[model samples]
Target chain A: MRKIKMIVEYDGSNYHGFQSQKNAHTIQDTIENALYKLTGHKIPIISAGRTDRGVHALGQVIAFETEAKIPSDKFYLALNSVLPEDIRILNSKEVETDFHPRFQAIKKQYSYYIYTKDSGKTFLRKFAWCNSEPLNIDDMIKACKQFEGRHNFLSFCSSGSSVKTFERTIEVCQLQQKNAYLKFDIKANGFLYNMARIIVGTVVDVGRGKIKVNDINDIIKARDRNAAGSTAPPQGLYLMYVEY
Target chain B: MRKIKMIVEYDGSNYHGFQSQKNAHTIQDTIENALYKLTGHKIPIISAGRTDRGVHALGQVIAFETEAKIPSDKFYLALNSVLPEDIRILNSKEVETDFHPRFQAIKKQYSYYIYTKDSGKTFLRKFAWCNSEPLNIDDMIKACKQFEGRHNFLSFCSSGSSVKTFERTIEVCQLQQKNAYLKFDIKANGFLYNMARIIVGTVVDVGRGKIKVNDINDIIKARDRNAAGSTAPPQGLYLMYVEY
Candidate 1:
């Protein structure tokens, strides 16, 4: 058997999520079905990030083991020819038999986009969160800095996650504004369920003056989900990169 | 009665075209329906450009006469509340009663986006034309200059147009490349049916080495549709601005 690693990109607008489920449309099921048509075998793949519904991805990493005879480097072209237009294989290569996508990952980066125009842009409605109300960028920037460090992120995690620990190390947290759009980027060792979105929500509240900037530290220390702001919607979140 | 001139924007992926048809969904029909809901009477609207199906617009100018008591500038906000997510009124103001969107227009600008990456971008699939083949940008740029000045564009115009004159002066024709994307912008006094798309198709053909760059002038002089290249698809075309 050969181990194959691939970088995938998907819109995720019409998908339930990255993970496969019964009686639902998903990115995993669509790709796996395309793989079945290509290799004539049921190939279950593993991904580094199992993104939630409506969350897009630019460089999602996945690995799978197969007994097919096709060369690994050519897998992207072959699979893209069969896969739907919303999901595409960007790069594919053979990897060591023991190589795993999730376990050996060192860091992951995510970005959330916000359209701050008074009138929303029609072309960007599916990809960006439209917040017409004015946001204090300086306050939002100050709040982002508070998130960069090791902390117990229990306040930012949603319910129903099976993880044992709520602690994670955040390496980078920053916000950049271009024209009428604001992009929030964060890098971390790992993320709990809805951690990024919750953090963004809290930061947005700070920008809106609903919460103070210096209170982010207290929110993290509170270690309670209710202490954080509401979870931002999934459409604005994008899994940007996975580093191993 | 007040004459209202509005700048509109729309994602035309789901509509038949800008013009209203008997049984098909269109941008015009949607807006008219929205206007009827806001006002108590049936009001017809005139647009600067009747974009084809799947052709987007960022600054489409439209005018209408209404007896509604709402302020002209506030009409955008009120109409947007009732309009669908894909269509938006960007700006609205009272205009002279004789202001016609089509006949009084002095110039119009349009843009076409092309994605040249070997692998298509999932997010951009709906808005850009994806051509994996390598293109010669310099050759295409040279061909763009030939499209400037006044010339008989009958060779580039598609059939079924009712215009009496085929001569139109182009003020600007340029192509800008950013990473894997190319944007072609053109400004003209007016356009024939499918003229901009055909011009792009011909320039693309020049980039692909299918046609010589110098042959453009002769093709325009020929004044026959058979002498021109194929019509580029409508999804990549956007009515950028309409000037009066």
Candidate 2:
């Protein structure tokens, strides 16, 4: 058996999520179905990140073992011919038999987009969170600095995650504004369920003056889900890349 | 009755076109239906440009006469509440009874986007034309200047147009490349049927070395539709704005 690793990109607007479920359209299921058609076998794949519904990805990583004879480098082109237009294999290559996508990942980067225009841009509605109200970007920028370090992110995690600990190290957190759009990018070793969204929501609340910038440290220390702001919608979040 | 003018934006992926037709989903038909719901009257709208199917618009101008008692500025909010998410009213105001959206327009701007990346970016698939091959942008940029000033654009105009003359002045024609995306922007006093798209297609041909830069003048002088390159797809075209 040969192990193959591929970088995947997908628009998650029409998908339930990355994981498979009964009678639901999902990115993983669609790709696996396409693989079945290509290799004539059921192939179970593992991914670096199991993104939430409506969350997009630019460089999602996945791996699978197969006995098919197709060359490793040509897998992307062969799979793209069969997969739907919304999902694509950007790159594919043979990997060591023991290589695992999730357990061997060192860093992951995510970006959340916000459209701050008074009027909506129809083309961007599916990909961005639209907020007409003015946001204090300086306050949001200041609050981003607070998230860069090791911390117990229990306040930022949602319920139902089976994790060993709430502690994670954030290497980078920054906000950038271009025209009427704001992008919040964060890089971390790992993320808990809805951690990125909750952090973005809290930062947005700070931008809206609902939460003070000086209180971000306290909120993280509180270690309670209720202490954080509401979770931002999934449509605005993007899993940018994963490094291993 | 009061005449209302509005700046409209729409993603045309779901619509047949901007014009209304029997049993066809269109931008005009959808907006008119929303108008009927708001005013309890069947009202027709006049647009500055009737975009082709799959063509988007960021600042399309439209006007309609209404007997509804709602404030003119508030009409946008009222109509937006009933319209689908793909269509939006960017701005609205009361206009003179004699004002017309198309007849009185002074200038219009349109943009065509091309994605020159080897792999498609999932988020931009619906908005840009993806071409993996390398393009000679310097050649394309040189050809843009040839389109300026008054000229008989018969070679660029497609069939099925009812215009009296093909002579139009292109005020601005330029190409800007940011990373792997190329934007061809053109401003003109008027356009013939499929004129902008045909011009872009011809320019792209120039970029591919399929046509020489020096031969542009001869192609325009030919004044034959067959003399120009193929028509670019409607999905890459955008009616950026119409000026009064």
TM-score of chain B of each: 0.98, 0.98
Model 2, span B183-210: residue lDDT tens: 9999999999999999999999999899
How accurate locally, in lDDT, is each candidate? Answer: 0.93, 0.93
Clashing pairs in 1: none
Give the least accurate 10-residue stretch of model 2 chain B, judged by summed lDDT. Answer: B118-127
Writing each residue's lDDT as its tens digit, candidate 1 over A1-244 gives: 9999999999988999999999989999998999999999999999999999999999899999999998999988899899998998999999999998999999999999999875536988879888878889999999999999999999999999999999999999999998898999999999999999999999999999999998899999999999988898899999999998
Clashes of 2: 0
Model 1 DockQ reads 0.61
What C-alpha RMSD does candidate 1 show over the true interface residues after superposing them? Answer: 2.3
CA error at residue B216 for candidate 2, angstroms: 0.9
Candidate 2 accuracy as lDDT: 0.93
TM-score of each: 0.94, 0.98
Best by TM-score: 2
* Fraction of native Cα contacts reproduced by each candidate: 0.73, 0.67
A-chain TM-score, model 2: 0.98
